[model samples]
Target: MERVYIGMGSNLAAPAEQLREALKALGQLPHTRLSGVSSFYVSDSLLPGQPRYTNAVAALDTALEPLALLDALQAIENGQGRERLERWGPRTLDLDILLFGDRLIDEPRLKVPHYHMQARAFVLYPLAELAPGITLADGRALDGLLAACPFEGLERL
Candidate 1:
C-alpha cells in the first residue's frame, strides 16, 4: 500500500461536522486504510468576505491508484454537497490529494503534492503534526516549508 496525504477543508454547512464525516468516509474507501489525521484548525477565508474555514490533513495507506483515489475523494466531496461554482470560493468540502507516496503526478484531472500546499499554513501546520520529516516528491523538505509558512491566521480547534 502506498502512503498518501489528503488535505481537507470546509467553510460551510457545519464545517467541523463535514470534516468528521469526510474522515469517516476516507476510512471506508476500498483497499484503503485511514492512517493518521491531524487536529482540526480554523483560519480566515482565502478570499475576503467568506466564512472562516475548518481544515485538517488525513493520511491513508492505499492500494488504489492515484486517479482512482482522486475519484473516490471527489465522490466524498460531492456526497457532502461540495460545489465548485467558483475557484477558492466557499464550499461545504474540499478534498485535495496532497502527496501520493513520493510520486509526482501531473494529469488533466489530478496533481499530487498539490499545487499550492507549501504556501498555506492551514495545510502545513496540520501536516507537520502527522509527518514532520516528510519530503515532497519534488524534494522540498517539510520542515523547510513550515519555516517559510507561518501559522499566522490559523488557530487549532
Candidate 2:
C-alpha cells in the first residue's frame, strides 16, 4: 500500500461536523486504510470576507492508484455538497491530495504534494502534526516547509 496525505477543509454548513463526517468517509474508501488524522484547526479564510474554515490532515495506506484516489476524494466532496462555483470560493467540503508516496505528478486534473501546501499554514501545520519528517520528491522536509509557510492564523481545536 502506498502512503498518501490529504488535506481537508470546510467553511460552510457546520464545518467541524463536515470534517468529522469526511474523515469517517475517508476510512471507508475501498482498498484504503485511514492511518492518521491531525487535530482540527480553525483558520481564517484564504480569501477575504468568508467564514473561517475547519481544517485537518489525514494519512492513508492505500492500494488505489493516485488518480483513483483523487476520484474517491472528489466523490466524497461531492457527496458532502462541494461545489466549484468559483475558485477558492466557499465550500461545504474540500479534499486535496497533498502527497502520494513521494511521487510528483503534474497532471492537468491533479497535482501531488499539492501546489499550494507549502504556502498555506492551514495545510502545513496539520500535515506536520501527522508526518513531521515527510519529504517532498525533491527532498524538502515537511517540517522545514511548515517553518517557511507565510500564512498564519491557525488555532488548534
Candidates' C-alpha lDDT:
0.95, 0.91
What's the residue-level lDDT of 59 in candidate 1? 95
lDDT of 1: 0.95
Question: Could you give me the TM-score of model 1 versus the true structure?
Answer: 0.98
lDDT of 1 by residue, 1-157 (tens): 9999999999999999999999999999999999999999999998999999999999999999999999999999999999889887999999999999989999999977899899999999999999988999999999999999999999998
Where model 1 places Cα greater than 4 Å from the true spot, the runs are none
- On the 0 to 100 scale, the lDDT of residue 74 in model 1 is 96
lDDT of 2 at 29: 100
Highest lDDT model number: 1
Instruction: Name the best candidate (by TM-score).
Output: 1
Candidate 2 per-residue lDDT over residues 45-157, each given as its tens digit: 98899999999999999999999999999999999999999988999999999999979899999987798788889988898888878788767898789778854688999
